[model samples]
Target: MRIFALETDINKIKQKFCHSGESILLSTPYHTFSFFFSSIRELFITIALFVVGIIAFIYDLPMGWTLGVLLFIWVVFVFFNLLKAYVDWLYDFIIVTDHQVILVDQTSIYKHEIRPIHVDNIGAITTSTQFWNIFPFGILKIHLKEGLGGDTVMLKYVPHAEEVAATITRAVSSHQSRSQTSAQRRELSGIDDSE
Candidate 1:
């Protein structure tokens, strides 16, 4: 699967990072049902338009138009709705790296918000699934530390949330450990000591 025309290869994405030694542990987009169901209103509208077009074709209106063209436009409308949903889902993503948990939210074609929670700054993680959600689809909330405004990264309609959370948790732990060890080494070298 591709995401907004971008290749979904985790390694390729990791390599794209400007900072060296960054490794992507997990990368995920919203679940398939999430994308499809989100455009329900558009789907209904497209269906209604298609029915209208068919009616128009059947009635042989005063305008000279063939059934083929009507059907083509109907298909195009339907495709547009689907493509919109896909583009929205594709552009937004949740990614866990060795250093942080990143939430890439694309609100519009030109608007994007990239929030990265450093491993040491993550306060908590919460997840919930709707009663009707049969698959591993749910919402994920990554709470930041108190000093950092205590903001939460809210991700909706995520798939395999349990695994994703675990991946983030593990990455956080590993990052914290690495930071701690590096700090300890600095202390040992008297770099943190007041001379």
Candidate 2:
């Protein structure tokens, strides 16, 4: 049993999808505030559970079925919410690997969507933020192959989104340069072959 659930989950994903020599450059989840604010209802429920536990302890409730039930309720509430948050934080990520950019969305345990866009296919990158348009956190938007009508990938409430966007942009540029060189060489060879 892995002591840290998040690391364990991430390891599983990496093991399953990462290709040979495709090292992970970066893996980022949404900002912490995003996790808490995304589900306000869950926050309230967690708080209420704490209150109930406190009340039971203060009242010196009988150590019988009632106490067990109370503890059980607390455990379940904490477990479910933690699980949900963990899943959200785990699957909802902006991952940059050597070969491509990966966007993962796991809305539920059984349902997940993984989109991998080659670095050469990325067309644009943008960032939206606060604190003079550059602060605590921001949104990272990645546009893929604009001429091909590729859709955008959004990583909301990402801390240091500006930096992440820059990294992706650099990778895209590097990939494009290599691709263009390869194309030019092929064209030159084709002309020679025709002769």
lDDT of 2 by residue, 1-195 (tens): 233333336566766677987878788877776666656766677688668767877888765755677668756866677667767765577788867887766655656677777887788999987446544788888877767688787777787988888888877777778789999999999999999
RMSD of 1: 4.2
* Reference-based TM-score of each model: 0.74, 0.69
Question: Per-residue lDDT for 128-158 in model 1, tens only?
Answer: 8865668779888888899999988777788
Off by over 4 Å in 2: 1-7, 45-82, 130-135, 146-150
The per-model lDDT (C-alpha) reads 0.74, 0.74
TM-score of model 2 (CA atoms): 0.69
Give the top-scoring candidate (TM-score): 1
